[model samples]
Target: MFKRILSGLLLAAAVHGLTITKPASADSKLHEADVKWQTVVNNGDLMPTAACQADAANCRTFNSYNQPSLNAKKRVVFRARSKGGKGGEPVHGVYTKDMSQAGPIVRVLDRDTEVPQPNNLSAVFIEPPSFPRIDSVTDMIATRGNHKPVWEYTLADGSDTKVGTTGIYTNPFGPLITGASKLGAVNEFAFFEVPEFPGTPFDVFPGSPAVTQGSTIVFKGNYTVNQIGKTGVYYRDLKNQSLMGAAGGGEKAAVLIANNTHTLIPGTQTVFGSTAPPSAAKRQAVFAGFDNEENPSLGGIYLAQLKPYPISKQPMLKTLVSIGSQVPEEPKDTRFNRLGEGVSFDGRYVAFWGAWGDENKIVRLYCPKEGNKDRSAYCMSAASGSSQDAVGWYQDKSVPINQGLFLHDINTGETVRIARTVTDFSDFVYWNFSGRSPGAGEGEEGDEDGEFARWRSASFLAVSSQIKRSKDDTPYQVAFKARTGALDTNNTYQNPVDGIYLKNRSEKSPFATLIQTGMDGTAFDPKAVFVDEDTGVSVVLPVTEMGLERDGFRNGRLAINASMGTEEAGWAGIYLGEFR
Candidate 1:
């Protein structure tokens, strides 16, 4: 319980209408702690031009980076692009750095790298997906490889060969297609087939795959059989070395956690219409599912056990929260309106995003068309003229969103509200650069695929069971990224300050702002600096963008994909902040 003095001071601050209130104690270690920051990579640094010939288009300096994933070993893996490579275009690939080793960034796999076996041997990788994940305990990385499909066929004698036209190519793998059939197979692929449902190979791995300790990989598999498409969340253990190829090996076959067809929507009479990618820790996984495939309005986050693969019955899903359930901390009649696609589970606790009530607002981004050659100048000028939104000629279609962050204790079945829109948070469904980059154009394009949009609600919450402050009482901690709301304030940015925050199960304040948009870059890096290209003026830029996902937060350290206001493109890179 908070002391009476602290409560009075906070009430006074609230009466004064201050957005943020700090603990007024000279020796208050409970409220906040110092964070040790380390830089991972930034733009303008010589990008590792591996696999590409030395004489290739000077594929030297990095241009941009996507959200990064950090593992327990202090290893960081992310997707980055370097322009002027080979064809005067951007060269992209998955790159990693072992912070424990303090070594240079190493290219794990790139566009120029060959697509491994089970696919066309001669084919090279196309654009690798964003947010490649690292295992909690190993160096293995799981990413979707985009490449030409390797067709398979059954000959007259009923033997399968690489000659059919099914073209089921793009799949997620651990860079190397095969490895020892044991835990921590860093070289094996995440390939699997359901024996009961043959002919429907896992053709596509949607979103980034989640790899738990011991190398158990969980991912959403999209496949079709007899022209009927179905999607499900499945997991495969790499311990069985013999089940390497596309067929099942009895108990070694991939276990289906949940799917659209047979998986029932808890507390409802309907079956699941679709399921989202899962977040796994140990042998347990948690994910979101909807009851309607096309326009889902029901369903919630679910938990599934992953061990004892050859079970006698289907795995039972434990519902964390659902549509008809009462919203936590709200009026009795307030029910959940929608759940997000992203969820984080670490066996004990589940962190997720939920929206309720009818109060909604339109989140609009300046999204210009990509192929509008004739209207490019007009669009550019219109975009440049607006400082409120991204530079673009037209605003992207507005999204009516009302979302919040929540944490549910699996042990107690208690759902606690972390923050809500217009109160604790300004926005949860939309995010953007604090300021534009000189060469970084549109924040998002109108025609761009919404699957990878930075503004999705899925980017809001990330939970880790390892950040518990006290072993006696505290259970877990969660890190959430959002634009500042009524409860947060930054001196530098008059607009809602974007930040990544930390909250525990037993925090007096709702959360502690670990890092935010307007903080000094030096806190993250000692040598961090920014120079104006035109006047050669140099200054320390403030923090801008921060990574928003579970992979960014693990153990007690947070992997941040932050930027220092765009004054220097190189200022934008990955950083690690460890709370002490």
Candidate 2:
């Protein structure tokens, strides 16, 4: 038979208080008694059940009797009855402070009810107040009443303190005030003001604020008012209040702005010097998108040189391309795809991936030398039929390649395929074509379809993959490589058939090395490699992966954005180890 019972009482001691004991357990059968505290059900009805028995103050029973061992400590259990003839009801247990003869305490209901109820009653363990302990009070002024009604509390020092107008009582923490409406009770209240960094006229209200690492807090919000002459951005410092800083034009400043198409490409600046940049000295760059007023073409690129510190001189901004100007017109139609995976500047040449005509994939190169505009920019064609998927340029103006790698002279526009093959066009047609296809017919002309082999890059390292077949017609090896010139059949690891990722080393060297392997699923898609000329190490940022994966690598940080179906969630994270 099911028999509910209460076992011996257990005491939960607090951090700053003395320990206390409750009623001792008896070596006898316990009888159940209805608890004064009732639980409100989902249907808006209250149900009364025996929480525990007299002898067993902490023990309760459901289908199977739960009898505490004679010498065991007391534990309380609350059982819920199943509805609609459902068999056994599950019992839940909770620990509370020891209360020998306490009646009841109020517990605020978490869920909403039919009527607006303030609070509810529940049985709980209460610790007795320590002697000479003081509790600070705040006055809560009643807005509905003609004369303000105040709630006050007396401290341990025999001093009566008034809790002024809707504030919470805290032991040592500062006052948590609840705001009152101008004419009636406030429907909502929040701590919107930035406590540590005060006196800035920017929007401080966050949609969701999270407290991190003791005193640090992070939140996101939109700027509502852009007042002229006001600081645009501000950061609070706990160590020194006087070290606070702000930036941007009040009325015209926007960290993130939109283009004509309403695509959001906001302005962002990263402060790197020892001291924060003054408002006038701060350098800003805009991310191009449809919503931005300046640049409307989707694949437009720009370059600007800003002063590192001091507000004395204005920075120089240069327009790299005005939207569709990068690509050519008509029969030589230039299809502008998304910006290639990577970008970098070496104070000399700027290299990027560009698509021309329908089948001509090439690498676009530009030299920043003064007055060299007409002859400064040119295209280096890739392998005859292969697309130049991604590209990167080293500090010395050397191009990197992957898949169909090739090299071309900037001055002459001369191009050559880095890797050569012994298999002729006829061999490819004979193996891949059939009698039904034109190439396989007895009298039909055989067209070469084997021109698909192209290297991905020529600078840094170009990695590619291919399945090698054994003499017995069995798949033998998967090859990968990072090649500068033609594929070196002599060096095994030098031309790895399995994909590889290269990063620039940071030890004041011009050379870069393979830092990651593409064989692993976690490895990013190798796109463009950016190497720190001072350090030989480099960072590899991938443009697309198995599942439309896109990533960005800057400095030593990596960011990955993955889209799943209709919903997308991503995070910018850091990875250890220099790109060697």
Q: Which lDDT tens digits does candidate 2 get at residues 1-580?
A: 0011000000111221111211111111211111121111111112222332233433322111111100001111111221222243333211111112221211111011111101012111111010010100111110000011132345667896432111111111121111110111111111222222222222222111111111121122222223521111111111111100211111111121111112222232321111100101012221112222122234333333332222223233333432343243223433343222222222212223232222321223222222112211211222222123233211111222212212222223332222211210000000011111212221111111111211222111111111122122211111112212122332111211211222121122222222212211123222223333454453332211111000111122212221111001111111111120
Model 2, CA-based lDDT: 0.19
C-alpha lDDT score of every prediction, in listed order: 0.61, 0.19
Going through the candidates in the order shown, the clash numbers are 5, 72
Candidate maximizing lDDT = 1
Model 2 residue 230 CA deviation (Å) reads 22
Model 1 regions lying over 4 Å from their true place: 1-33, 51-59, 151-175, 178-196, 240-252, 293-297, 310-313, 368-402, 431-457, 468-472, 485-494, 532-536, 567-570
Candidate 2 global TM-score: 0.22
Residue pairs whose backbone atoms clash in candidate 1? 43-570, 181-239, 181-241, 383-391, 383-392
